[model samples]
Target: MSKLTGTTLAALAVTVLSALPAAAAPEHHGDDGLNWSACQGQVDPRQQCASVTVPLDYNDPDGQQITLAISRIPAAESGLRHGVLLTVPGGPGGSGLNLPSSAAKRLPPSVRDRFDLVGFDPRGAGRSTPVSCGLDHADLAMVNLRPWPAADGSIDGNIATERRIAETCARNGGPVLRSISSANEARDIDRIRQALGERRLSAWATSYGTYPGAVYATMFPRHTDRIVLDSNDDPDPSRVGRGWLAAFDQGAEDRFPDFAKWASAPDNPDRVADTPEQVRPLFLDLAARLDHSPLPWPGANPAELNGNVLRETMLESLYADARFPDLARLMLAGLGRRPLPAPVLPPEQALQNTTAVSVATLCNDVSWPSDPTGYAEDVAADRAAHPLTAGLPVNVMPCAFWPFKPAEPPVRVTDRGPANVLLAQNLRDPATPYRGALKLRAAFGDRARMVTFDSGGHDAYLANGNACGDAAVTDFLVTGRRPAEDVFCPAD
Candidate 1:
């Protein structure tokens, strides 16, 4: 997701149905200064909230401190508690303080009984000491966040926009902003671990969260108990966040067919075409028409639905099958078959915070090419190669003009850790495609095992109803039992 995952990050998880008995779990263990109190918002009653203080800059451990908002639901049967099961939400921006309640609902009660479900607002995110770039409201648009190239594939606009955004962030974002990075997030996870009084912690991380999850596993090998990375990202230390953005090209190609198949079903009220083969060309034609003549869409951020907006919608819709109808509705409205759906927008404050962290993480993770000419060429090439994404995946981002360099090199995930990692991946994920997961798998080498699912969308284990994938990951988390070899889970 580059945490480009919009506001739907929380919905990116599958259900669990593990047949393993609770006997394989570990003994109960936990303690901390964390005081149990009901969360203030709409979270479940079982969830208790607390705060953990850590140095804003790890290098200066005793310097200035910041508070991280954390939450958790105790194991249903504390007698069976195995340890903490930390939930790492996607987005450098997504808030996880409220996620424990929701995640507990998705996890099998047997697993829940053996582990305390924990979540946190990563530094510079929600309820933690937050950071904002004071960006203009218009900058919060999905098309801008995704860095879609112009219809002609010119990146002049992208370069200028990125420069402006970078300048704005540097002007208002302070030292705390500079402290946010994947390495530091890994360090912060360790802090969370110590605060929980757990010698080892299991983790379930998806989308952008998988990067930090892997980093934590690599950096704190002895402290990690079990890790389940769903919808993974490329562990390419060289390109870093830039590689994640570029992945959308292949990701869309991998995922669009599922949407096509769904949209072309004869019984579908939102059928866009009679055959899957026709769906792609029809979509391309519709997007091309919109590129020239955008339809007025009242109340949307830009106040109009243009080709790029539709394309952004397509990328989001492909993250899950449930979102397929959103793209279908937009396509139908673009063709004048129906009125446009009401505009959906994240709350303004949340958008501002998320956009800031996303930009900071991507820019702070690595350096990006500053030359517009190079980006333009790349965009044009990508557009020709992957028409569905229209070169947006390779377009320049705010990182191109960021003022600061990475504080530390991106963490290289090595194959030196314990064999406690289980990866669940959908072959056709649009955000973190299966190809990227393959890279992560290679990086972990003998330290990990993978369960591939013949499914589409971002989340796999619980999302596609793939019982095989779900059981594999669940068994690992619950029983610490993984397949002796890499496994394949056919779609249900």
Candidate 2:
């Protein structure tokens, strides 16, 4: 749900450390260990970790306190230092803590040596005072947590599921849940910029982070430096989070071709069909069969491989090219051509944090239609139009039943910011999809010029490896030069 793809999740995890409480304001124990030491291990050596205290809620700046875990990779050469560059990770749940180092490696030498890359775990995520609904392990599973309806298109099960999830989160999530909106995250980012002693900060924000970044640029226009928003989401304020959830239908449709081609390739070990076109119907048939009769998946949270669960996994796997095989293998297993073991899920702690933050941000961003009838109507219409998604995108979520209303209205992304923003998007992103990116682009208007990549899966920039698209982004980041007009990079 949300932009909580695995890459986004992993990035958020590293940043999660930034949200942790500060060690008793360290004694003047010296610049001995303070000199920008190399970060240890997989956590970027270029990045130096630190903490900054921000209000739990920005509206009440003098209220309760929370600490944000912040990291910085200084400009390589002081003589070339230009300004600070902030890396905003995706997932309202995702963390940006280690992004400074991660993003530093992606920058061209020109940009890397000119700016200190900064990253932080937003409040209610990762290292920042983490929030959990204390949900049971089963409830934390992706399929269940996302509120996918029963196989036969029944809203009854979904409604019940939403109520249970919403109630549990309300009871156990504490006050932190109330403060987990994207608006709050944007305010927190501004606070981090102030803490960094910067007048303006260049930023690279992706997926869900794009919305907050755009909001930040709008809220504090004078404080924004060059900005890059990758894998952008629809910035429709009225339907903010709902638009993202609804977008999965289009996203899955956009990305299925990549999976189809892979599954149909003659050389592939898990080839499931003779042609790309055949792959879709074959998958649909398999899911429908499983819907009526689920296969026992011992040790799995749901205890069975139901149709909706399989579909959900398929959607998740489509986020990256590396995950294609997982979906193919499952397809083979479901076809009884090559039985395989069940997949291992993430640790309980990780799942809880992910679910908690995802739900909180989505529900707190805007009000979801509470009527079961409304969801039923939308699901029916969506099912007919996009069967691959199985009406899941339009179905009810915990937000529909959430007891708490959003404290603030969703921030509308506008053209009121500096014209320093650039957006990079994959044409076939399963999570953020191109159609939605177009909406965000339209919202930003002249404020952003997008570089659309002819590629499949989610995320763009360094992770996607499309040289044309990557070069466009790198050029913008380094030179603060965006294309005078929108550009498209054909698939290589």
lDDT of 2 at 260: 93
Lowest summed lDDT across 10 adjacent residues in model 2 is found at 8-17
Task: Please list the residue runs of candidate 2 whose C-alpha ends up more than 4 Å from where it truly belongs after superposition.
Answer: 1-41
Among all candidates shown, the one with the greatest lDDT: 1
Highest TM-score against the true fold, candidate: 1
Question: Model 1: per-residue lDDT, tens digit, 211-260?
Answer: 88988887877777878998888888888777888888999999999999
C-alpha positional error of residue 162 in candidate 1 after TM-score superposition, expressed in Å: 1.2
TM-score (C-alpha, index-matched) for candidate 1: 0.95
Candidate 2 Cα lDDT to native: 0.78
lDDT of 1: 0.83
